[model samples]
Target: MPRERVIFLVDVQSFFASIEKTADRSLQHKPIVVAGDPERRSGVILAACPLAKQWGIETAEALWEAQQKCPGVTVVKPHMQKYIEISVQLTAIMESFSDLVEPYSIDEQFIDLTPTLHLFGGSPYQAARLLQHKIQQEIGVYARIGIGPNKVLAKMACDNFAKKNKEGIAHISYDTLPATLWPLPVRSLFGVGSRMSRHLERMGIRTIGQLAQTPVERLRKKWGINGERLWLTANGIDESPVSPRSHDEQKAIGHHMTLPRDYETLEQIKVILLELSEEVGRRARRKGYVGDTVSVGVRGARFDLPTGFHRQTKLTEKTNDGLDVFKAAFDLFCTHWDGEPIRSAGVALSGLEPDHCRQLSLFNFETTLKKERLSKAVDHIKNKYGAAAILRAASLTAAGQARDRAQKIGGHYK
Candidate 1:
């Protein structure tokens, strides 16, 4: 039998919010909001569960406003390390179902479930429900799955499931398109943002059915090439594949940590920068990759503060040595920061290529070899003991704090 292609769009339900609930059983049924403190300039809500939505709370809203809407809303701090750890495990679980899993983000993925559907008794719904139950049981989080003929409709169905129902799985086939997809608002389409929605409204196009039938010329005149793509997606005509173990567009490998409290001393922030650089370098070497551009991001007390800064500098050599990354970050900090209190910091590397294939000057070959040997030795010791087994004096002060934060997520390298 010729197998029919089926795209599965899987999304973690209220990811950050759900993680908080998992950690504390008391938080499971109550309305929860995940965000930074409103007192600081970083008081932005990042994620909220459906329970919070009932009280008019939403992601990206001001924390203060969200509190006003839902006075009993419990606020939880962001623990990205823990979230990423869970994400890594979740990704592995998805890959176990089939090799054709594409990570859409930290909390979402698309899987090609076409060939394997028959193994689960020739029913897409049965496979989807089974997957959903497995994820919920293993990860302690709810995930809604959407199964469709293509990726776009599957994604749309996922979004629709999140907003309208909690069936744990939603299916959208061509036969049920009119009943399931036609009444959806055009704004519900993936590419439709605020400005795009206004443009669509102005054209008197208000529904997915209308968009599917709108003249291509009129759409192209308004949105150019993007308009044509949207039209196809609205009509469930997306042809993109769900590639499982595909090549990634990785320009760099980096890791960053945000502090629970701000530091007023330059010495404190410098120590943090070095730790972050070490993390980024370690990941780079693990993947046998190196990059020439190193970037630093610093968050101040508030958005209006001039101290909030981001700076990137090119490295003198293509390397993943911790010292090289630290040098770049130090240069960046010296130029952009003025010893203002630092709330958070992150480091990244870009302009990446395979380490073995990277171009290197003949004169620096010996120096590079020495650095690589030293890095390997350090990694061996840390891998055997812990990340804090051997740390430079510069990062000693911030080591304890960093470990404590990463512990919340049970740190896993992806």
Candidate 2:
């Protein structure tokens, strides 16, 4: 027998900006925006409040463009710690509702109410309302939740309908699936990114209904396993479990930075790569793993043309040393680079393995040992005092952004 699932997806609206308003009461009624890179007023807007959004201001736009849209829109720096603290509080609230709560991200979650609805007077709607009201009163952030027979429907309902509704909630099931889900664009389905959407578009599959009705054999012939999977998703037939363990999977560890300005010289570009290498090495060392491959990507500064270069090389041995990562990235850049102005640069270490085993070469053993010692000492100093407590001479130069980046989390205000 198939049991009906009761899944609810909760999304906090403009999370960062809402937290800014809640922390500072005066900003609640104003046009609030949370942005990064305070040194550049033209820096990216991470979040925008409802009022600012009304004026066509949006997240990811330049702050200067936002000000132009809503003239004098209030700008605030992002507080990652404060947001994380509040997310933890929200998690606690969801756990109170049901033991099957799964946190999807910083501002999203899924709660299964199938087994726990009896405790809430046998009404999932009532439980949902209670959670919404309590969060507003306690946390002062508005949340919209979508209810469905499974996770996929719940997510789509929340994104397509619930967030825009007056009640901030929507419920979907077998009876309502056809009218609600079938009419949406095929591209609107989850897991369908830009590339997939264009491929489906070329095949004349424009809407979910068309996709669901297409023959299984035809879809399989077109996309192999992925095509069949898309067909199942379109039909609202998902058998996958909502496992929380998925978050633990780390395939690659890397960091990328959009420069304050373009880098036209090789010396300037390599300096940025070294800074990124340090952070990547620190992260890998913290996790006690080393990568078998190193990759580098450089994005062009010219927005109109929008071109870049990428290269990856296999390492003779896995490494977590800062200097090794830098050298690998530098060699890639030297080999593949065309000397174009670079707007961003990134370094990644992948094909991870535990550091417990060792395979050493007699020739390079001494040099490798020295680099490892230096990396550990630098990591210790930064962890104890601060990331900016010590800096390489190259980072102190005009080309380096390590000082400004040290205080940031994922290239945004900390």
Candidate 3:
């Protein structure tokens, strides 16, 4: 039997800038480009308010380009601490409606409203509308919400309803999906990215209806398991649930980054590693967790196409300390250097458990004490002031850009 489920996909509008304007009334209705300084040519454009978008500025655009397009744009560096504080509060608010709120990302979440609609004393439509009003009124950020029988459908509905106005809510069911959804382009479905869209276009499948009608075996032959999944999505047949648990369960924690420039020198690479270590360590401490494994990834410079080293490593013990993670990460980098010019690198920590889960190693015991105290101090400063209150030297450049761009500094190092 199909269990009744109503997933609420809530997406904050112009998240970073919106939050900033929400906090300070003075910035409202002003052209706001949250990003780094145009001088350094550093930092990606993170978010833009409606006014900035009108000037052709957008997230991930170069700050210089944004300035050229919109001379009056105001760049504001990110406030990671503020975003987190607001996220915590918003999550609490969402939880009040149901215990099954799953944060899909920093700016969005999925909620299971199946069981609680009756208690709210109305139809799901009424409940959803009320929820939207509550979030906008309480959080000071307008959000687009979609309701459907499953998570994926709800997500699509949210995207469909996210047009110019707060026509802000959409509900989709299998019975009405053909008219409401199938008319949209194939790209409207979740799994179809640029590459997939090109492939589908080649096959004369330009619409969701065409993709849905394609034979499953034909899809599997071309795109493997993902093709079959795509076919299902085209038919409005998403069975995924609005899980309270995150997808992070099987893995503890991991981080990856793309470099703006390639590096050949060991010193330059070491600086990058130190920055990554600081991130892994901070997240571990924030969650009261530690990991027994530390792994690093490298991508070689690609003149023709992007490429490089990708590898992992096991550690001697679990640790939440940046120094230890950095040491292990550096050791792996040296092992894999192969005299190649590195383009990008990343670090990850797995085998996580609560800090008190295991005993410290004899070699690590003494050093762990010092690391703990230092980490706590850093965390306190970051928690109170902002993520920039403490950072490794390598991060200063990016942090400065973040300040200019108006991103939440210290975003989960995804």
Candidate 4:
């Protein structure tokens, strides 16, 4: 018989806000939130501490709404670089407990402790407690841990039970699913959100147990492989491994920006599109990859109605040149745009291959070689000085966002 797998999904409580509290002891007990600059049109709550949560402040809510809820809420601008550094440090700490550690996100990670459980305390709970304590002691932040036989149950355990339980540790298994997880609403399942829960409820599967009891064939016929996967997850069956290199595999490189105001003209929209294309190209080059597919996405300024288009086109040859990407992206935009006042635009490159594998252009061989060398030189200068060190003439235009974006990470101040 095979040994039951012991997996843990560890989540840092109010990661960004907690880090802010830890860095400033004066705000340790005060209601606080990490938010973007109000002047930049990114004035939304990114993370809120427990005290803030008590005031009904939530992530993704407008900062003004949070302020209305709690007049004295201490708002701290996000330090993305600091958060990333601490996340890396946290990952290093988890690696000490087990070799099979995978980062699910900046604030969540999965660790398979099947083999190391005995080394820690000979029991799953004992090991989890120790790990939790170590994180608090070293990082000055609280962690909620969910233990299970697989990743899905572990994630659900953390989100549904551990975070709410007093001890901040919860365990779930196939044996416990009927008694513990099945009684909850179907929406509480890891993969089931509001939209999916509605679909399941319409099928008379209002609880996880109901979903688990429904025929897999019925779900498979409806949602194809996804429905079957949901059913398996409801049954607490997940065979995925915790691999450390999960994020190293890149499928695409993309960048998106929400404009300060609506851009109504094609020229203005194209300016932002070109800036996005440059960023996409720079990132791809930094990673030593080239791509053949360019995608353009645009969203309208109207919030009351749905509006936007995401389209992609394949080039004859893969290239990481900014101008090349912009040409393709611009063509796509011109072909599909509906002439709405745009609020945001994005550019992406996919169908990736290593730069070394790129075939020389048959017609523009010399020009291509020169462009590649020039791009490398520019990349080198930017890396040594800063991202804003070298810029295209278009980036100096009022419509360009590259300058402002260079000062940010993930659309927030670094």
lDDT of 4 by residue, 97-205 (tens): 9989999999999999998888998898999999999999999999999999999999999999999999999999888889999999999988887999999889889
Off by over 4 Å in 3: 1-3, 162-166, 247-279, 297-311, 333-346, 354-414
Q: Which segments of candidate 4 are over 4 A away from where they belong?
A: 115-119, 194-207, 214-227, 262-270, 299-310, 331-342, 361-369
Point out the higher-scoring one by lDDT: 1 or 4: 4
Whole-model alpha-carbon lDDT for candidate 3: 0.78
The candidate that wins on TM-score is 4
Clashes of each: 2, 0, 17, 0
Ranking by lDDT: 4, 2, 1, 3
Please list the C-alpha lDDT of all candidates, in the order they appear.
0.81, 0.87, 0.78, 0.92
Q: After superposition, how far is residue 306 of candidate 3 from its true place, in Å?
A: 10
Q: Over the stretch 1-414, how does candidate 2's per-residue lDDT look in tens digits?
A: 576888889999999999999899999799989888667544789899999999999889888888898887888988887898899899888888887877799999888888888887776678888889888988999999998888888898898889888999998786788899889888888778889888888889898888889898999998899999998888888765665556546688899998989999999998999999988899999888888899999999998987798889998989988778899999999998887899999999998876677676789989988888888899899999889989889999999899988887776666
Q: CA shift at 278, candidate 4, in angstroms?
A: 1.5
State every prediction's TM-score relative to the real structure. 0.80, 0.79, 0.78, 0.87
**Over the stretch 81-159, how does candidate 3's per-residue lDDT look in tens digits?**
7777777777788888888899888888888978887776657677777877888888899888888888888889888
Candidate 4 local Cα displacement, residue 204, angstroms: 6.0
For lDDT, the strongest prediction is: 4
Residues 1-414, candidate 1: write the lDDT tens digits.
334578899999889899889999998899999886454467788899779989999899999899999999988888877888898899888877777899888899999878777776578888888888889899999888988889888898888864357576888887787788878888888888888877888888888888888998888887789999988887888778887645476866777666777777777877888888888888888878899999999888655765678889997778898879988898898888876787778899999988879876899888888888999999888778877677777654653355543333323221
